[model samples]
Target chain A: EAAVTQSPRNKVTVTGGNVTLSCRQTNSHNYMYWYRQDTGHGLRLIHYSYGAGNLQIGDVPDGYKATRTTQEDFFLLLELASPSQTSLYFCASSDWGVFYEQYFGPGTRLTVL
Target chain B: GQQVQQSPASLVLQEGENAELQCNFSSTATRLQWFYQHPGGRLVSLFYNPSGTKHTGRLTSTTVTNERRGSLHISSSQTTDSGTYFCAIGSAQGTGSKLSFGKGAKLTVSP
Candidate 1:
């Protein structure tokens, strides 16, 4: 199975604070994604990358930025955090050809005060 | 924009019973997947059935692409089976990495 891990499993910050959520996948999957889970929104994609230095905008890209420094690492950046941006974030990875099945990380719970 | 809708927002079942979950999409989807997430845990892929039927363990997933709908059947439910089930759909024209997910169906099994 693909192993995806996220750092700082839990985060707390005040408004205007900058936070960075890191993700790394050992499966070497070409596609990596960042999603936020909310009470009624389920999971909404924020950004995704197909390979190193490749970035793709997702459904909800506002107030967020993402970087894929390497094939195995993807990061989500919150330059100015807000309460609305506080949610459970998940990082997932999947092979290039097989995009339907994605392996997810444990998730990062971000709380903005 | 694409949308996925799951029916029976919440369900309660006794152990050993059978449970059925439904998913409906607003647009044509090239890929459909079922995922299970325990409370406060990560989401795990249960089935990747875009069309036809696929079975694994006691779980069965059937997707009718033409109908833009899918169903997941869980037989012999257990207390451990209690969790939220999500249905996600991917477009055929895009990078295939983007998936639109449903609000999910919360299932609780009791002994």
Candidate 2:
């Protein structure tokens, strides 16, 4: 089975605080994505990386930043956290070949106060 | 903007019953996928049907590319099947890997 894991499964930060959510995948997939899930909104992509050192802006990337330091690791950064950023964040990884079946992490529940 | 819409926002079923979920997209999609999200848990890919029909276990997914729509059928539902089902559409343009997900259809299977 594909393995994707995220760190700080739950976090609480104040407004303007710095927050970083970590994700690592062992499936050797080239594509990694970060998404936020809110009530009635399903899942909204915030950022994605095709490979190490690559980053692509997603549909909702205004208040978030992401980095891909290695093939196995991806990070989502919130430099100035706000209450509105409070949501459940998920990290997923998939390969290019085939249908690009994505495997997701357990997700991080972030609360910005 | 490309949009994916799912019908019957919510569904309730009993054990041994069947369930059908629908998904429609506004634009042409290069890929269509079905995902299951457990309450307070992660999202798991159930099917990656870009076109035609595919089945795994008791789950069957049919995607008609020409119509830009897809359907997922669950046979003999179980309580463990209760969760949110999401359909995502991917375009050929740009990265071709980015997916636009629908609001999802929440399913509740009772014993």
Candidate 3:
């Protein structure tokens, strides 16, 4: 099993607050992704990166920005967060992109008041 | 965008019973995977089946690529099997691929 860890397992902030969720994968996978899970929306992709300094827009990329500074690190930034953005955020990594199996982190629960 | 639909939406089963979950996709998918999320918010990949049948422990996954459909079967369900199961379909896009997930089938196995 690949090792994927996430920091700040839980977060709470007021409207228009800044929040950053961090993910690190020690498996050296080339692809990393950020997704949000909501009640009726299931899990929607926010952003993804194939390697360092490379980013790709996903199905749901609005209101979110992502940076892959290094192959092992990927970050999701929620600037001026809104109450609708409150959801469980997950980060995942895969060796062969979305065609292969992905290892997921424990997930970060974010609440925007 | 590819659309994935899961059947039943939710299921309730007793311990020792068998469970079946279905997934259907609107477009052709080159790969399919099943994931299980624990109540504690941890997600685990259960199977990466593109076609045919694969089994691990009491869980089995069967996928038909041509039909764009997949099925997961759980034998002798246990209380620990209670969680949300997601089915994702992968489609090729240029040099890479993209995955689309269904709303998921919430299963509750009671003692």
Highest lDDT model number:
3
lDDT of 2 by residue, A24-99 (tens): 9998999999999999998998999889999988889999999999999999999999999999999989897226
lDDT of each: 0.91, 0.91, 0.92
Error of 3 at B69 (Å): 0.4
Candidate 1 residue runs with Cα over 4 Å from true position: A97-100, B93-96
lDDT of 1 by residue, B79-105 (tens): 999999999997743554588899999
> Residues B1-111, candidate 2, lDDT per residue (tens digit)?
779999989999989899999999998888898999988667889998889999999999999999989999999999999999999887744653687899999999989
RMSD each, Å? 1.4, 1.5, 1.0
For model 1 chain A, where is the 10-residue window of minimal lDDT?
A94-103
Candidate 3 global Cα RMSD: 1.0
Complex DockQ, candidate 3: 0.74
TM-scores (chain A) of the candidates: 0.97, 0.97, 0.97
Model 1 compared with the native: what TM-score?
0.95
List the candidate 2 regions with Cα displacement exceeding 4 Å: A97-99
Give a tens-digit lDDT track for model 3, residues B44-67: 999999999999999999999888
Interface RMSD of 3: 1.4
| Residues forming the 10-long window of minimal summed lDDT in candidate 1 chain B | B90-99
CAPRI tier for the interface of model 2:
medium
